[model samples]
Every structure is written in structure tokens, then in C-alpha cells.
Target: MFQGMPLAGAQAGGGIVSLIVPLVLMVAIFYFLMIRPQNKKQKQRNAMLNQLKKGDKIVTIGGLHGTIAEITDDVVVLRVNDVTKLTFDRNAISSAVSRETAVE
Candidate 1:
């Protein structure tokens, strides 16, 4: 009876360890596959937003396209046409279509 009890306890302990290893592996995979890529994309988006300047043609998240007419710390003015300019939060700009480069 004593030998049987020891064997059962050892088996239970090994079962718990086996379960723990797979659980840990799943968490690691989730972080690498999901969380890490999301964080990298967020950093790239922030860098793009910070580099925004006036005259850069941009597309908004809502699909509106225009040139940046004016910029402030938290606001952007988009010129859709000669008489149509719109104001939006800096974060509303999705991607810069083109950046105006200085002519040498």
C-alpha cells in the first residue's frame, strides 16, 4: 500500500508539470504572435504621426484625402480643395500620400 501511494503521488506531480509546460508555451506563443507584432505596428504608427508636416498629402481614417494645410500640436487642417478645408485631430490622419520635398 505504501509503495502504491508514492507511485500515485509521483504520477500526479508529473501530470501537473506536463500541464504547466504546455500552458506556459501557449502564453509565450500568444505574446510572440499577437502582442509583439501589435506593439511594433503601434510604434511605427507613432513615428509616422510625429513626422507629419504641412503640405504632406494624406488620407484620413474615414477615407478622405487632402493636403495638410496647417498643423498644430493636436490639430491638423486639411485642404481638400481651393475653398474646402477641414479640421481634424492629428490622430485622424491615417497615412501620408506624399511628403513635399524641398527643391534643391
Candidate 2:
């Protein structure tokens, strides 16, 4: 008849719910604050790579700047200068430098 049990402490089963609620909130906060933006950025980068074409000036992940001379399935030929053309993997190409940014 509830004579030997204490029902108003950490053993009453309410502590688990309180602990889990904060943990779930922290996870949601982390996903929104950190994971979401990174995923969006990656999607934008992938879209840029898929839309690449010849004469588009770009900079590689390794800091090499050039114009796209040719694009194959997995390779990109960059016209670094008049006489220098370098071959690199498609994934190595980083963000595309806007045409306006290169003119100034």
C-alpha cells in the first residue's frame, strides 16, 4: 500500500525523461547549427561542378587558377596560361571564380 517506497525523488522515474529531453534538444540544435549549412554548401558545390563548361575561369582546391579548356568525365584540362595546360581530377576543382571577380 505504498508504505515502504518513496515516490518523490530520482527513483520515481521522472529523471529519465528530463535527461532525455535535453539530450534530444542538443542533438537537434547541433544538426541545425552545424550540419545543415555544411550540407547546403556541398550541394551548391556539386551543382557548380556539374554545370562547368569551357572558358569558365576557376580556382582549384590546391590554389591553381585557370580557365577550363576541356572537361572529361573525371578529368579537367586547365589552361593555366598560353603554353601551360594542367590535367586534374574533377573533384580537385574547387569553387568557380566569378567572371566579374577575375576582371578586376
Candidate 3:
């Protein structure tokens, strides 16, 4: 009697593929929008950290600004003032201020 109608128990329209396509698209969008840019920024930050040298003025994650006096594999000694120096982790550095950039 209902030959033209879909059965309630039928497998239905687009099966597993339909459900998966949107999910894959969502993951792709998330990676492109969020993950990829974040990874790129992290790599740039790592390169900047690796290039750190003595006398480079840097800002720390805590917003403290100082010039690098000494650096080891994992430690950074900042000369905050003539008699004030502080030690921090290399990773604690947020950004470095180049001499040219500082002059501007």
C-alpha cells in the first residue's frame, strides 16, 4: 500500500558517509582556523628564543623588561638595573626588543 514511501526501518538517505563528511569538514576548519596558526606562532617564538644573545633587551611573560646578561641552556639572567639582576627560565621570555626596533 505504501510502495512509494520509505519504510520506517529502512537504512535511510545518506548513510555513514553523510554523517562523516561534516565531521571531517569541522575538523579541517578547526585545524586551519586554530591549530595551524598557533603552531606557526609557536615555531616563530622558538626561533626567536633560540637566537637570544647577551645584551638583547627582552620582555618576560610577567611583563618585566630587562637586558639579557647571561644565558644558559635553560636559564636567563636579566640585568634589570645596574645592581638588580633577575634569573628566569629561557621560556619565560615573551619577546625581544631589537636595537633598531627600540630606536623607533
Candidate 4:
């Protein structure tokens, strides 16, 4: 005869705590490992974009290198060569090249 039944209340509390603890740990790990670094990089990139000016040599995300010929609100004109100029969005620029590097 199977007449021994465990009370529901005792098991429910442990079950809830076990589920909640892992969910909280997962969120904390994701924030530190993934979200935090991505946000920091975005802030740095935004600062670089805002400081762009004429004669700053830069490389685009597409690997083109050029000097900033002009800057508008959201666009950039790049002089890749003496007669070759290209236009791109400000966000397309990756990083600025130093004057020494630009000369070489």
C-alpha cells in the first residue's frame, strides 16, 4: 500500500530558491562578461567620433585609409589620394591614424 505522501509546502520552498539562485547568477555573469565591455567600447568609440576633425587620418570599417577632408553633422569626406575622395557616414570610421603613420 503506497500511503506515504510528502507534504507539498516543504518541497515548494526549496524548489523556488533553487530556481531563483541560478537565474540571478546567470544574469550577473552575463553583465560582467558581455554587456559591460561592450558598453565601454561603445563609449570610447563615441568619444573618438565626436572629436573628429580635418586632417585626421583614419581607417574605415571597410579597411580604407584616408585623411579627413571635411566633417559634417553625420557624414565625412575622406581624401584617399590626391584626386580620389570618398564620402562615408561618421560611424563607419574605426580609428584615427597618427600623423607619423599617415605620412608613411
RMSD score of candidate 4 (Å): 1.7
TM-score: model 3 vs. ground truth: 0.85
Model 1 agreement with the true structure over 6-63: per-residue lDDT tens digits: 5666589789999999999999999999999999999999999999988888889999
Worst 10 residues of 1 by lDDT: 95-104
Which model is ahead, 3 or 4, in terms of lDDT? 4
TM-score top scorer: 4
Using TM-score as the yardstick, the better of models 3 and 4 is: 4
**How does residue 52 of candidate 1 score in lDDT?**
90
What TM-score would every model get versus the actual structure? Answer: 0.82, 0.85, 0.85, 0.89
Whichever of 2 and 4 has more lDDT, that candidate is 4
lDDT of 2 by residue, 31-97 (tens): 9999999999999999999999999999999999999999988999999999999999999998899
Q: Candidate 4 lDDT (Cα, whole model)?
A: 0.93
CA lDDT scores, all candidates in order: 0.88, 0.93, 0.92, 0.93
Ranking by lDDT: 4, 2, 3, 1
The TM-score of predicted model 2 comes to 0.85
- Pairs that collide in candidate 2 are none
User: What would you estimate as the lDDT of candidate 2?
Assistant: 0.93
Clashing pairs in 1: none
